[model samples]
Target: MGHRVLAVLLLVAGFVVLAPGTACACSCSDLKPADQMRLSAAVFTGTVVAARQVEGDPAGPTPPIVYTFRPDQVYKGEPVTEVRVASNAESPACGYRFSTGGRYLVFASAEKTGMLQPDPGVPLHTGLCMGNRQVALGTGPVRAGDPVLNGDPISAELVDALGAPKPPSAAPSAPATAPPTAAPASPAASTGGSAPTWIIVAGAVAGAAVVVAAWRLPARRRVRRD
Candidate 1:
């Protein structure tokens, strides 16, 4: 009875030590490419412009690693020129390490409230199990069943599932060119190149009155001489 009790105590101790590792171990289901695309909120091909590990409270959970991407093509969701994706900081948590300047095909999901979000406004999150893989920078045509180039079979599968991708919408078409405003007229041009009609009539009446006064003066002189 004493031996059995000691053995049971040792077994319990072993289980306690192993439990943490088992709980944190990363496991992923074998989902097909199409299924992976469907589950994702946003899918695109981009190059990692920057990457950083977020700092968190020491007593809290591990911080997330964030990658900033310049998207080359968008397969799903609103087209964006730049996107930020956050992931776990360690492999056990399924964090994907992306190198700066390396091109990749990313499958990301919207994480509204979670430890995976490194910042308040970050809209996307990705992991090793999210079907994110690095690809060559070649701009060649994508074909199904080919090796993982920029436009690989996986990308082809995404294209088939979500149709062709479009580039980021251009700068709102420069606000329609503003229709060429006409120049304002000068003060002289606005008056039609003429004086007022009332002023001209007043000048003519003054001249006629001066001539009548001169004629009356001459007649009065002739009458006085007679």
Candidate 2:
């Protein structure tokens, strides 16, 4: 009985020591790409413009890392021109890292702050569990400084799942296809337009010729009869 009790206590102590380490790392069953996209709040392709180290609690270890990205495209969520994201510099805090000048296809969460708040109105962030990572180079041929050279379009039925495909840009590109709209034609100016001076003089000359011709025609007809 004494031996059994000692063994049980030792097991408990061992678990206690190991628990902290397990808890510190980002833990999740590895998911397939489709599943990752399904679970993410937003997914996008961006180029890392900067990685700024941030200080956490003074009592804590080194600060986490914040990454700034210039987004070339958004695969999901409301379209935004650019974004900044934060993650742990180390795996222990579940932080992810971003390399300046590198491009990535990021799976991220949008955390909204009040409009009155300073900084980004809403910021994006991701973690190891979210599957934020680099796109395989073979994804596409990219030109220099292309923000989304990180990745090209992902073919998936799930594309429809990304909130109505950003509702197509409000501005219409091909005017031909747009629905015809009726605009009330402006009524011809109610005021009369002045006739040109040359037109008036020509009309007067035409009237005088008609009168003279009519008078001459009568006289010529009478002379012929006589």
Candidate 3:
């Protein structure tokens, strides 16, 4: 009986050690450029300025990686100079891996909610199979008639589906100069150019009269006591 129990325990330990860990499997539908455009909340071509992995929940799954992008051209949604996009940290989870300097066309969705809610600053999220493809990095804004790069078919497709892209809207123009703050009125100006000259004289005269009356009353009180 002891020999049999020992063998059973050894078999169970071997099974535990040999078992394969579960993995995340991601699936996406084949979507055309037009369909992708319609499904995405924002579409733009940008270069990754920075990338960082956000820490995950200790009790949950791995967190997403965030990439900061400097938009070269905005094809859809509000034109922004800078935006952050989040993706799953693992390739098996369909994360789109972005390099620090690589330029790519991105199809991003709006912010997600719940436990995996993206960073508030990162208002968009993307994935590996979301029709995202790398492009030849270039200088200057994309123009309507500019020549397409040798291997950049994605840009051509985007232009066909979404038309010519626009440069990011200027950084909101410094908040409209705060309306010049109206230059706080001078003290004199605030009080409507001070009291009129006559009013000033009247105040001085009334103050003098009060002083004289008080003096005269004190003298009369002394005389009555005598």
- Cα RMSD of all models vs. native, in order, equals 10.5, 12.8, 15.7
Deviation in Å, model 1, residue 113 alpha carbon? 9.4
Worst 10 residues of 2 by lDDT: 112-121
2 or 3, greater by TM-score: 3
* TM-scores, each model vs. reference: 0.66, 0.47, 0.58
Model 1 CA deviation exceeding 4 Å by range: 1-24, 57-62, 111-121, 138-155, 169-201
lDDT of 3 by residue, 77-150 (tens): 88889888888766655667888998877888763432232343576778765677777687454443444333
Of the pair 1 and 2, which is ahead by lDDT? 1
- Write candidate 1's Cα lDDT for 1-226 as tens digits: 4534432332233222223223355656665677667667788888899987887766655678888998877888778888898887766666778889988878887734343524534778877677887876743323455456443454455557656776755556555567788899765566796766666799999999999999999999999999
Deviation in Å, model 1, residue 208 alpha carbon: 2.8
Q: Which portions of model 2 show Cα errors greater than 4 Å?
A: 1-23, 111-122, 136-226
> What 10-residue stretch in candidate 1 is worst by lDDT?
11-20
Cα lDDT tens digits for candidate 2, 128-165: 66666574333232233333324444434334333222
